[model samples]
Target: MRSHLLNDTTAEQYRRSVTEGVERVAAKIAATERPFTGVTVDALAPRIDGIDLDQPLYDTTAVLDELEEVYFRDAIYFHHPRYLAHLNCPVVIPAVLGEAVLSAVNSSLDTWDQSAGGTLIERKLIDWTTARIGLGPAADGVFTSGGTQSNLQALLLAREEAKPGRDGLEGPASLARLRIFASEVSHFSVKKSAKLLGLGEDAVVSVPVDTDKRMQTLALARELERCVTAGLIPMAVVATAGTTDFGSIDPLPEIAELCERYGTWMHVDAAYGCGLLASVRHRDRIDGIERADSVTVDYHKSFFQPVSSSAVLVRDAATLRHATYHAEYLNPRRMVQERIPNQVDKSLQTTRRFDALKLWMTLRTMGADGIGRLFDEVCDLAAEGWRLLAADPRFDVVVEPSLSTLVFRCIPAAVTDPAEIDRANLYARKALFASGDAVVAGTKVGARQYLKFTLLNPETTTDDIAAVLDLIAGHAEQYLGESLDRAS
Candidate 1:
């Protein structure tokens, strides 16, 4: 039937398939009553494993019917208000439309000829973001998969820049002396990137954080001085614009001054706080970001866009040439000589998806200000949730949020034993997830178990927070009671 090819004969079939698929998705979204359906891995795995791929259904309806039972029935819905889990956002509608178009067209954004208009669109969006970040005229960037890749690329550039002048003995000996500094609370990707870059685990030095969980600049200055005395090269100082667990933003202005003084590269991981670029009122939070050598921004995390919307911006555009590779068949030296705008020249990837269209459509439909307001809404909700947690006396709310995440653990006044409280909090989180009424996240701080409420949904109200808090408290008390019964 040549159904795979999208020619004139298969055009009607394509339209019908899209209509049916979207209808099913819409129905699923509308019918989802909970954030999760509480289906365990053991129960779901067998159903999926039982599907005989050799036996083809040969009909889209039959395939979708099987998918409904195996996948859609228990899928977690991030759009639901009760989903106070991860950094997943309920995406804006325009981005969803962009996804449909990009998927059908299947544009590859590596070379100029393959993309053309797609390349220009991505460049324009990068320019817009750079302007918003105030990275100056020489600033340039490229869209990446997410923050991890962006951070890796940023550190790679820093390592290349940190190379010692050749004196006939500059191979492994000099590379071993290179060190990267980051706050203890910074993303784990920093250490992982160091290892991938052949620097090993010892190359990363963790700087201490203050009581507010922000990196202490004075300690950082001291570390830099120590590095100079020890004949170690400080390759990069990675500052966190938003930490995952605490949502605390390190003091960037002070850190930037330290990096300048030490002649070290500054890389700001603004994956979670990049929404401030659009924030009219709170943009000052990332004031020193423009001074950074490089910055990582994940629009997917905070811009109300779907997954895979992120970019790595560099202050001096020439720095991106560090990632450039001349491929014979793709972005060759001849293309560079011709001044062709091949995005692959600045990317760590070859066959990249046109993920920028999602952000472009989102910015066009809901202007930058609209996304900022949505971000502000969630921050406001976090404040309310914090107040509720603080007043209830059941939860030991960690600190006031700098963004939309609250890290706290259940600790009723009656539960005096610290160990028991920790166990109870852990038990409560699992019980809530197993019940499937709501979904929340968990983390640990200083060997103590903590429950996290990453409020990314602006639609999630104080009422929803209260309901989840009630569930947490109930489960905690029940767990404690059960433990006491077992003890007796």
Candidate 2:
């Protein structure tokens, strides 16, 4: 009689809480970024650890204060323009809001009852991505944790589809003799997926790359022929749309042709580059992606969404049936009669978050062209970086900027010894971090170490690159002189 469900929050209460929290975070982010001093974490660690951390453990306000402290102060703000490390970048406002809303609802997408509207929303998103990728109207796919899981799911299906008489074979042994072909520049996930699928990493044939870093189509064809002649089942061809090390896009049209000729499943891992589909200029780069048996796309990468928003898109909806398993309670015998395509049947996970909402909201708010333009802007910035380095004799740009990645080494004309040059570049990155000049990622290509920059933040400009270059050059001079002095 005394309002038994008072504890249950009303919609108005939920809305106000979300609105207040978002406004506060937005103001904090804006205010926090006001000072543009270029110092890295290594320089600030001593000062950062001096902050207080105790009192009012039971109070909600205190808890929120603590959350803000950890979130703002200690956290390496990826949204900061200087954060060019790895592939992490600034997520957009709309997507961030979507993340907040979804987190508040805490919807579990595992079953329809658990998330009725969310299930439909995610399905619609999958359908939209599928059609955009040129899969026929009947194609289907599901969200995964990231590109790694998407790659794994694609390969799992490939193994099942490729196995001779696998439709009836019930054991792992039946999947033997299955092989996959990918480029040396391909992400390590393919090798990991092979090992996890029981096919062994040896099963993934490493194809050679051309001067441009693209997977050699001719080499792939030869490997496929050899695989057939050897009587091994050609399971799948994993073509990379944007490789991790160089951001090189493989020749998809030629690869797709081979897949057709040899009847092998073609899975395109466009994890970093699939967003190019939105751009009029770069869309033609992935000309034959339409023919892929499956595709992997990371919304978190190019869509400006928060993490854990990745997908595996299959050419045919029926291929997902290969991963089907039935449970009585969740996917009941009686419910099967209703013909609700249980997403759980196609996924590798049982408990899934409503990740598609973030992407869905982003696309709805900005439209496909807006997202495409964002990709174009970043790619243009990368091209600008490439041009900047190409004109500078002090630097050695290893590869042409691909998509949003810039790979170059800080080797001035004064340095001759390869060993010493390598040492200079290594210390320069550390010095850059130590000095808080900029946050940059480094990788080795062949025999030399090169600093890499991934430009996913649309707000970043050529001026940012100029500042980082200035820092790198300054650090290089200091490091190189010390190396020479030490040797002398």
Candidate 3:
């Protein structure tokens, strides 16, 4: 049993195994030739099914070799320059070091005894972020799993604030009358949160968006007025700091003013655009974020940190008490009276990871200005990509991007029909992915299917964007030709 523990006798073996494993992984990441290997479910499923879980390989090297064959060989490489799909960012090196350190220690951040200084580290990071958002002195926040969890927790707090005394009521009639206002383009989590909170889907009222995909403030104002007129409660206004598909930010100042007038809780889902907090030149893009009652920020999405790094920040610290349940075995009343910081009090989770260490180490090593510069680079690349698409006659570029996402569709000269163009673009996206030449995203803009480029890699340049665009065009043309031949 003592041999199982990492003591003086086993330390050398443990160190060798861990070091070799890390080096192998780093080598693979460094040697990856493409952003994706186009490994399909049908191909990988058989290999995965062949694994014998009950049989343990005594040799660590043999286990690692099997891992390489089954997992690492075809894993999607977000660090690759051509990987332009989704909101995944290439992580910073310091954050990777933080992950290694935190994982080895296995610190649980739920209580002071469980985490000790880990609790302070997370709280310090939260305080630093809240200061950047200008949430004032009373602001507090807790690290969450990701943006979805953060959004759910934010809405939970909003619900508690909206109706303080209706927790154990008979029927959810009051909850049914409560409405959440958000843009038509906002994240799906808002409606999901409502459902989980017993407000039902109908409680979510979708406000219309403008041409740029940002929320229309006038429409929101009118909707709030209508809610008031109907004797309905406008519980919260959910604003999108950066929408998923288009990366469009709503008019936060105007929306915040409307929320203030209507006495509604304001929650901004800034998961994709939270990097604006560190942005040096373009911080003004998220100008009114400071006015939000609560904001969800995903460091993984835009801060170039690993996954599970995000937080839900509240403007007033007292609002976090809504999530507190004094467990006798955990954070008891006496502990609170003694002013010990138990993070479990504010978080939706009891067993939480010290995810804040990643961001803290990243900020300390890379500096906030450096992170901002990296984000600016990607935004600049998107602007350049927009110009390239706008000039090309084959592609129909959407509105100018407010952030690092470009949503557009293919409309080659060969495809005259609207439905045919949609099919062609969809086919091109799928073909491109299957070929593994590039990884791009796709979404539906109204009724038409559009391809998207979500650039989060600072290393990617205009030439790389042009190459991917050319590939997209070639795929679209090939698809159209194939269709024509089939018709003939």
Candidate 4:
């Protein structure tokens, strides 16, 4: 057991163990034919539950052998090109190498002393990201767990800054009257943040969106005026850069103007569209992102990093004080005067993983353009997919993708009932997932069932999209035919 530790005494053991594990994973990747094995919860649960907690495998090889049967065999492989369900991207090789290195070193980024060079690395990455967004010289940010946490932190700052006379009403006493205006299609995290911050139940005002699925600036203006008239504190206006379902981006320049007039914090949830920042060709899609007071960026979603890499950036570095706290034992008050950089002072998290190293390694290994070109490829593929969906009579695509996602549903030629069509689309998605050839996602759009393809894998070609569409059509047609037979 002592030999298993990762210190200098067991360095050889660690090397051999890690190498063997990597080799096994490489072999598994080579052998995998599809994105998944279609293993059900019932089949996998018992196997996981049967493992005795007290029992130790003693040998790494034996554990690896067991993993092949219980874990790796049924694991959903996001790296596969056809695993087009959500925002998960096939990670880049350089970032994967960074994951390995950072895991071994195990640097905690909360305090500078704990992660000396790691802190600098993360800070530089944050600075680089702010520069890309054109957030100005005073911009600052801290890496977080993911987009949800980032959104929470951003809104938390907005809540704290809503003092009396700044946005109307008293500070903490007016919590119930504090309202956040956001587009109806905005991420659910905005509402969740409002609840977490102890705002009223009706704090989040859902403003309507335009035909493009973007936020309606006129409606937002009316809502802001209403809030002011009603004597409520309009603390924040969240503008989405990329909606989860439609990938629609709200009109940012207009929303920024509204935020200025209303004296409210402007937050842009660019969890998906942040990739466009790196995209040389598609950068204009999120043109007004710089106008946001604060922004959320998820590197894992589109930057091709691994899980647990995201950040919340604020234009005014002083705004980060809302999240700061000074403990005598850790980030002491005196340390602020010592000019020592402590990431925890601006982070919601206390003990944070060095997730930024992954991005740093990625940037150093392959310049930003390398990552940008890969993202460009995926966006191009999504455009091709959208075109294909438009020409095919079996599918009705929603709004054209502003990013790399297409939401559509299979429509049978003879089906008249909308409920039956919804069932067909739902069945098609589930059937495709069960067969293990491809995986897609389904969501409701204005009371109709629709399927979504989040194209993040550059390797996924137009033909792959065509093939998957045909599969969905076949499954839906089969379901509809079975329904007709039952009715007759």
Candidate 5:
């Protein structure tokens, strides 16, 4: 056990074990032919369940060999060029190396003592992100596990700020009257945050979106007025810079104005669109993001970093006080007086991982412009995909992508039944998944099933998009034929 520990005495053992593990994973990646094996739970679960955790494999190689049967074989390989499903990006080598170093060090990011340079690195990264979003000099933030946490923290601050009379929303009576405004297509996190904050499900007022799937500013303004007229407090207006299904960015500048007029907090959930901040050609797409009182960015989604790398930034650094708590032994009040920078002061979490190191390494290795080019490639690929879908007679595209996602559905000309068309599209996605050839996401646009291509891999080319479309069409056509046979 001591030999396995990563101490100076066991440095050689640590190097050997980690190197073996890395090589094993590298080999599996190199050999993976598809994004996944389309593995079924029934088949794989039994193998995992059969493992006896009480028994230990004395050797690392033996443990890795055992892992091959359960974990590695069927794992989804996002690095594959054909992996067009979801917002999972192919991580850069630099980020992966950073992951290795950080995991070995295992620094807790909550306090300065636990993470010395780590705290500063995270602050620097937060500063870099806020600067990119034009959050101004007084802006400050802390890294979160992901977008959901970031959104939650942002809304929590909004709730606190909405409290009036210096005592704050003062009581539960005021909490009951608080409301959040968001577009119908905004991330579900907005509503989830409302619930976690003790607001009712109805607290999230769903404003309508325009033809491009963007939140209609007029509708948002009307909602804000209605809330005030009814004596309800408009806590916050969540403006999504990139909707998951359609990649539609709401009208940010207009939303910001509405928030100001209503004296509400404006939060831009740019988890998906934050990549545009690094984009060489498309930075102007999210022009009004700067006006947000708080912004949520998921580097995992767009910056090609690993999972769990995200930040919630604010225009006023003081607003983070809503999440702050001073512990006697941890972040004591005296620490603030001492001018110590503590990440736990701004985070909802305690004892968080040093996830900022990955982004730091990525920036140091490739620079932001390198990330911009990678993100731009994916966005460009999505445009080409949209063109292909628009030209194809068999599919209907919902909207042009604002980032790197395309939502479209296969509509068979022979099928007049909308429900049947929906079934064909659904069947195509499932069959393709079961076959382990390609993976795509499914969503409903106006109660109709649609196939989605969330292009996050830069290596995924236009030709791959065309190929996936052909596969989807074939599966859909096959399903239509099967339905006809069954009907006959």
Candidate 6:
């Protein structure tokens, strides 16, 4: 038996390894800061092929070296200003250091025995997050992989709440003719969760969105009425705090009111936009988020944590008991008598990471205002981008700027056919990425294709956006045979 493995690695060893790793990663990040093009992939692949899988893996040094080469080298640099493709962004220093510490400790946060102090840390964070959402001190939640798992877990709770005394999710009566309400523009994760929860995809009712892309509250009421008339139990209404395609916020307070009136659970999937909680400028948009029965927020998206740090908060603490199970020896007698809330009682996973430390470190070091400023800065930059696009005859912004993301299409004057506009937007977005000048994504809004930019980095500026726009315009002029004067 290895003495190091038995006693756990020493603090000095951990410190030395982490410091070295951090420096290496930082240098790698700096070197690959620019938008990577085709040449590097071909150059790097040949070296990767030289690796022998049959070799015995022994030391952490070799493991870290390989990771630095393949994983870190190939990974997209979200910190790069030109990589404005998705919600992902550069992580903060505090959280990065916190991950180092947490990995050194190697705590399994599933149970009290496994986690110890880690259990307390995670619980406190959950309590703090619950309080932020207007949930009472009695409310509880567990960190999840991301918003999807959190959403799935929320639906699972709803299922259990709807069907009491059921052996499993079987029988027509046990299933409870259930239906969920969400905006037509809301994430498909809701539909996926519904199906996984045995409600079937048909059970997710797509409520209409107004011209602003917000879920129409009146339309939701009508849909709830229709479901009730059809003898279906209205399980829940999901409101998007920040929708995926367009960062549109559904009328959360209004949706909460309807949920209250109809006696249905309200689950807010604020995965992308929940970081606005830190921002005073945009917090009002998610006003009634506190009233939600459950809420999903991803620290990975907004808090600048690494991937897989997400949370699901429920308004009632006792509600978590719905997912509880007991394995005699593991959580037996005295352990259960101690009344410690085993994290496994609530989570979907058995060996969960100590993700709370990252957020805790971030909040502790940066203070609330620091993170809030990042959120505000991103939203402000997005609005600036929207304003730029609106003023320019070359582009058409889909909706008013809501959060960090803005969707717009490049419309040339001579192109009356919406088809041509869509084609131009698609080509322009692709052309910008392919040229390695700048990066932005594309999405469809009501049959029209539009370029999408989701800016999460506070360092990204209006100037950066303008450069991308110019590239987009140049792409249109080159490919679509449209002159600058013809750009609508």
1 versus 6: better lDDT goes to:
1
Model 6: CA > 4 A from native: 1-17, 38-50, 56-74, 164-176, 482-488
Task: Tell me how many residue pairs clash in candidate 2.
Answer: 3
User: In model 1, how large is the Cα lDDT of residue 110?
Assistant: 96
Q: Can you tell me which runs of candidate 3 are displaced by over 4 Å? A: 1-9, 165-171
- List lDDT for all candidates, in order: 0.91, 0.83, 0.92, 0.92, 0.92, 0.83
TM per candidate comes to: 0.98, 0.91, 0.98, 0.98, 0.98, 0.91
What lDDT, from 0 to 1, does candidate 4 have?
0.92
lDDT of 2: 0.83
Q: What's the distance in Å from true for residue 184, model 5?
A: 0.3
Instruction: Write candidate 5's Cα lDDT for 1-488 as tens digits.
Output: 67677899999988889999999999888888898898999999999999899998898899999899899998888899888889899999999999999999999999999999999999999999999999999999999999999999999999888885534467666688889999998998898999899997689999999989999999998888999898788889999999998899998888888888878999999999999999999999999999999999999999999997999999999999999999999999999999998889999999999999999999999999999999999999899999999999989999988888899999888889999999999999999999889999999998989999999998888889999999999999999999999999
lDDT per residue (tens digit) for residues 1-488 in model 6: 25245245565665666677777878887787566452355767877788888884576677788887777756667888778888897899999889877887789898898889899989988888888778876789999999999999998887777666334545854464888889998888998998787776588989999888999999999999998798777888999999998889998888888898888989999999888878866778788898899999998998788887999999987788777777775655466678975888888887899999999999999987788888888889988988999899988888887888988877777668787777777888776765666678888887888888999988889999998888887787565685444775
**Which pairs in model 6 have colliding backbones?**
133-290, 393-488
lDDT per residue for candidate 4 within 128-147, as digits (tens), equals 99999999999999999999
Query: Which regions of candidate 5 fall more than 4 Å away from where they truly are?
Result: 166-168
Q: Model 3's lDDT to the true fold? A: 0.92
Q: For each candidate, how many residue pairs have backbone atoms clashing (under 3 Å)?
A: 0, 3, 0, 0, 1, 2
User: What global local distance difference test value does model 5 have?
Assistant: 0.92
TM-score of 1: 0.98
Would you give me the overall lDDT of model 1?
0.91
lDDT of 6 at 211: 84
